[model samples]
Target: MNKKQETKYELILNAAFEQMKEKGFEKASISQIVKRAGVAQGTFYLYFDSKGAIVPAIAERILEEQLGLIKSEVKENDSIDRIIDVLIEQTFKLTDRNKEVIKFCYSGIAYYDSFQRWEDIYRPYYLWLEKKLEKAITTKEIAQRKSISHQAIFIIGLIEQSAENYFLTDEPKKDEELNLYKQDLYHFIKRAIS
Candidate 1:
């Protein structure tokens, strides 16, 4: 599609999100999205099968965007701890601003029977972590674990678990406390692995 088409599709998706937030996901209407987007109702159908498609699409976009930050932050020669710290800090910061997006992720799974597989949407982070784990082992910085793949997966899963909490609960951490938590987590992971 052309740039104009892509822009309109994005606008429709953005409007759908606002409507979903204001009205709960199940109750958010297609007309509301179209009206808010200033798009003809027909235009929305041309882009998304339903508002459900937009939920996963938005999630996929977020993962892709954040993974780019990870790529730029991690240098080839950086220590495993530094790489992990970069991932942790950038992820926590990203999640702070995009709580609604993360909420929509879990809500997508709950509400949309047909939402895309999260693995497919989030493949880049998985692949990057896998590569880092491989390097850490070769450098002897990472101790042998029960399948490094599983460990790396678990680490990412832990962050996602944090994301869910960060979305749904009121964190008592002031900024300083949160920084300490990040440092503690980094040290814990580094010691646990290396």
Candidate 2:
């Protein structure tokens, strides 16, 4: 697509994201998204078949943004422990910031056509984490003889689930308590792998 098309595409996605956050995935209307994007309703159909079609784009965009932020913060020579710390911090920070969108994405996986495309949407992010874990093994930082894929999944799941529990679940936690939990979690994973 050209510059104008790309700009309008971004606008529509941004509008959809904002609308989903404000009104929720189920309630956010396509017309409002188009209107907020300043694009004709037909233009939305030109890019996306339905509101659900945009859900995967939202999920993909969130993952890519988080991955970029994490990559920028981590260096090639950083210790494995530092890498893990950065991953946990970045994942938690982004997940907390986008709780609404993340929740919507999960709902999309459950209810929309996104379930069939889950692997396609998330494989790159998962592979990136797997490679990071593989690097730790090669550097002799990770002593355990475990599958990098499993390790990556475990680490990512722990961080994401912890963030969800703190931000999206009904359980209440104070700032101090949350920080303590993060420290405990960081240490637990570090000891388990390294």
Specify the highest-TM-score model's number: 2
What TM-score quantifies how close candidate 2 is to the native fold?
Answer: 0.92
lDDT of 1 by residue, 103-154 (tens): 7667776667644477677666887898889888898887767687777777
Clashes of 1: 0
Which ten contiguous residues of candidate 1 have the minimum total lDDT?
159-168
The 0-to-1 C-alpha lDDT of every candidate, in the order given, reads 0.78, 0.85
| Candidate 2: residue 55 lDDT (0-100) | 89
Over 45-114, each residue of candidate 2 has an lDDT whose tens digit, in order, gives 9899889889888988998898899899988888888888888888889988999888988887677766
For candidate 1, what is the TM-score? Answer: 0.85
How many pairs of residues in model 2 come into backbone collision?
0
